[model samples]
Target: MDNKIIAILCGLLTCFHLSTAFATENGSDSFSLGAEGIMAGALPPAGLYFLGYYQNYHANKFIDGPSQFYVDANAVVPRFVWMTNHNIANGQLGWYVAQPLVDLKVKINGLNDSNQGLGDLYLGTMLGWHHQNHNWLAALETVLGTGDYKTPSQTHLVRANIGKNYDTIRPIFAYSYLNSNGIDLSTKISYSWNSKNEATNYKSGEYFAGDYSLGYRIQPKIKVAVEGYYFKQMKDDKDNGKDIDFKGQVLAIGPAIQYANKNWSLEAKFLKETNVKNRPEGHANWLKLVWAF
Candidate 1:
């Protein structure tokens, strides 16, 4: 038994242990679901815009196997977008960046741990088009492993991690159809390709996630909607070249409302998860504010 081989085996076990302890079967990736609700696919006109998001996520149950754990997490993210006047493929070109500050707490097996720090950095480029009653957007986004992270030891007892400590590249497509009668249907879908974590030698599976909204305008500046998000891992996670049977999936739906004016807009939603598998069954409250400059 070589020392290097033993060390590698220990690392893989620690990786799986940490994932199960955190209660996220996919091992906590950088993409956070339920971040977009109303007007999810609509891109603003050419200008600089600022968006702020606040989310409180609470979970008391973990499905798939019997588990006694609860998680409470809060995130505050600030994003900036510059929609340039330049055109690409007959659409507007946009660039955006987001940074998140996260506070996370977990109680598993009567042991408590917490972490508060910066999460991953997200940046993307998008091309948007608006024609008559249709809106379309395509984006290439990347999540950088810029947050605080450490590999847990073989003991598997470690502090809660707020970052995935890996890079992810996602391709997103969004569409919105707003009719003359103030009815709107919008959706944004994305696929993620994850890179291996250098510290743990683990690579998370690919994921397919989407957000959808259906709304009816009650006033010129207000709308009421039902919004939701869906997530599923499309591939198996890998640890040290061995496949891990970790397939996480969830669906959440809730009511949403938004108010918009010429300069700014605010939207809020509460999503309750259902049909969860290999993940935490939880609800999230999200509030988003966007203002144009």
Candidate 2:
């Protein structure tokens, strides 16, 4: 069984390299941030696992405004995970609070000043199952949010994930929905692999194009890591007046480094759009921090 796991990991690593080669040929510098907070757990435990994270986003185009920018600061406290001792099955229940504080210095080209506020609030939860190999895992999760934003616009989300690990290689696939007044579907796949030199101290791995990362353990008290990812936009309902649509999709990527210990941790990542679909004003970066007990 161990040998089989090792083989899978090795195959995954090779695929990672091959994917990178293909991405390079496409001339796409797409990148993604490494998984952050406790969602990036090494393995599932049998007891209650509590996790939380805070992310701040600065964007010029959250909607269809001019060069407007806003900071979205969100925190999820005590998101809980429960795993049965049997290991074949597990469940997760969690909630999060998000607030988008906006500062629109440059009014959109046409929109009025009355179309602004402190942003909306959001909350969510999930459930999952584990495979017997200790290498494969899968789950389904749902999230909903309400507040002033719920009036004209509300947030609803549902997602499914399948992930596998082989020794030092891990790959994840997820399908998600962001439904407010309009519905948005997002599909994403990512992989991570440990570097060849075990003694190098940093676990180096690369995901699609710009999604490369390096992680190092800082003794008993801390660990530091850095990573990046690419953002792409799919088709939306701009032509169909029934649904909400933005100018265009923006492609962005950035690097982030983090420090963490047993009781607490801090993370900071910067993201910028490399590709602009239709909206040029919708480009910005952000930073985030998290804590747990």
Candidate 3:
């Protein structure tokens, strides 16, 4: 009787670990949401700028599965951009690199695990154009899977890795219309292509994602807005070249406020997730700082 009890307990524990991994494998990806809001399509003048971001995310419910699974993640990312004097088609040329340090934790059925390390590296270049009241931006970004990742075969029981162990390529486009009357509209769109995880023979699907914001300047240096984002997976995941049924999607919206001066700006936002599918239902809070240096 004692032996049987122990065996059953071990099996149940294993199931819980697999379930946790399932939550991450199907739903989460390399992209970070809520990274931009107030000036989604605007780039600063030709100079070097430093941007800092902090995000806190928490989820206690899962769609299409048990609600007991919980996830909490925090990240701090610092990005540097340099816009050069050279112009491309009447647009300023710029390049940037971002590195993120992430801490992630998950709990299910009273079992919990955590991981902390660098998440990924972002390398990109962009061109920004401006008209009287309109601004446009185009960029190419790449995600390098430089974070810590472990294959199922390498882990003792569960994979609590913080990285995806795959490369991703993306193209971004943005537009902004800022009216002198204090009304502003902005949007940023991007599509990603993920490569196969050779260690596990699994490949995630392609995804389309973007951010949108509408704001009214309450004062000369203050603005308030409603901001949101949408993500849709366009293809099915695959394992060993065969398709998997899981495809995740989500939409989130929230409030944002910003204060800006000639050389620096600060922005804060909170986003609540809804209409989430094949993923964890979560909310995120973000704080950003940008300075011309």
Candidate 4:
């Protein structure tokens, strides 16, 4: 009986997931939008809810295929998620969207360059589920990236790049568990399927990424946590029938906080990239607000 109880407890406590990865220049991140926890953690009966998400990302250095350079890049993304009271497979269903605005300046090989523009458009569909007692919640989602590639805004002096100019279809799974003793764990996992960039004739490789968090509820309205993410490009990039060889990996970790009540939810998190290869190193900050009726 003791062993069985221990096994059950471990099973209940040790499950997690993450997000997908994509391409970007210095100071730009379409991935790791500070998404943590379970979107399906709790299911609202039947109604409309609003979710507002914001992220500020900056990168100062990076490695591009064996050459390192200095870059000052910043991207701000404002996103919205709409919730519906409808149900599917015992879960709530919804859709969400966003567009990114970017400002980037690079001092590479001794040349100063910069560009600012609206990067890309994003869309997704979601299904969320919550276990009884609010101890566990899970979500499954499909997100699409439009071919935002290089439009006029993407064609700046030096053709400064904000959008990667490719299409992506990624599936995500997220879950969270809170123990009776106030221990909370949440995670998400995703795999990205990528399409070619018609402008550069370059097709970026697909990648996998995830976010994980552990925290303790300190008060009825607040929980403090440590959060992190990891990204890995699974294969080589291709350009015009040739290998571009731009696969890389990234890892980051930091602190996070959440405050919630019956009608509002607010969360903030900061992450610092500590390990990277074949990509830029940077930090990301996120703020999220939600209102429900």
Collision pairs in model 4: 17-188, 17-189, 18-188, 18-189, 18-210, 19-210, 149-165
Residue pairs in candidate 1 whose N, alpha carbon or C atoms collide under 3 angstroms: none
Backbone clash numbers for all candidates listed: 0, 9, 0, 7
- Model 1 residue 240 CA deviation in Å: 1.4
Worst 10 residues of 1 by lDDT: 3-12
- Taking every candidate in turn, the Cα RMSD to the unseen true structure, in Å, is 10.3, 17.0, 11.7, 8.5
- Model 3 residue pairs with clashes: none
**lDDT of all the models against the reference?**
0.72, 0.29, 0.72, 0.55
Alpha-carbon TM-score of each model against the true structure = 0.90, 0.45, 0.90, 0.77
TM-score of 3: 0.90
- TM-score: model 4 vs. ground truth: 0.77
lDDT of 4 by residue, 113-160 (tens): 566766656667677666643423233333333422333223242334
Model 3 residue 118 CA deviation in Å: 0.9
- Inter-residue clash pairs, candidate 2: 30-210, 31-229, 31-230, 32-228, 32-229, 32-230, 33-229, 66-108, 252-273
Where does model 4 exceed 4 Å of error?
1-29, 37-45, 64-68, 73-76, 133-157
How should the candidates be ordered by TM-score, best one leading?
A: 1, 3, 4, 2
CA shift of 188, model 1, Å: 0.4
